[model samples]
Target: MIVQVALATGFVLILIGIYGALTQRNLLRMIVAFTVANSGVNLVIVAVGYLPGRTAPILDATVPAAEAAARIIDPVPQALVLTAIVIGLGVTALMLAFAYKLYEKRRSLDIARFSELKW
Candidate 1:
């Protein structure tokens, strides 16, 4: 039940973020919405690896390493989500830089007004 709820919430957040990104024209708003969607995706990925009745993945003398490995949460999804987070940060930085340059060149923040770039 808990996992189901988490997954549903994540999907709903992702949908809302995508809708905002698609309909909103302001560059800053679009970037924020994209980040929102990325967060939702990250949440879902992390949730998928959760084990309800498992101990931590630490290998102390009390808990055997092999036993922990058998019941501990999956680490693969966590690792991939970390990578996704780094990539998302890079994309956000690049988008912000591009947006800043556009604002400087055009002296306007209205995305609609940026139609006729000299590109």
Candidate 2:
């Protein structure tokens, strides 16, 4: 029930972000929407990899090594999501930097105003 809700929320966020990114002509707004979409994707990945009633992949006195595989949740997706989050941050920073440079160059944030730069 909770997992379903999370998945639905993630999908909804993705759709909303995509819509915002596509419809907005402002560079900053589009970057913000892409970040929202990226977050939604990360949520979906985590939700899909989540296993109910499972513990983290840690072996202690209570959790024996032999039963670790069956008792613990998969860690791969979590790790991937962590890495993706860092990469996403870097990408967002780059996009912001580009936006700043473009603004400084043209004094405008509207993407349509920069169409002449197209090759």
- TM-score on alpha carbons, each prediction: 0.86, 0.90
Clashing pairs in 1: none
Clashing pairs in 2: none
**Segments of candidate 2 deviating more than 4 angstroms:** 117-119
* Candidate 1 accuracy as lDDT: 0.87
lDDT per residue (tens digit) for residues 1-50 in model 2: 77798899999999999999999999999999999999999999988888
What would the C-alpha RMSD of candidate 2 be, to one decimal place? Answer: 1.8
Q: Each candidate's root-mean-square deviation in Å?
A: 2.6, 1.8
- lDDT of residue 101 for candidate 2: 99
Model 2, residue 54: distance off in Å is 1.1
lDDT of each: 0.87, 0.94
Best by lDDT: 2
Model 1 TM-score (2 dp): 0.86
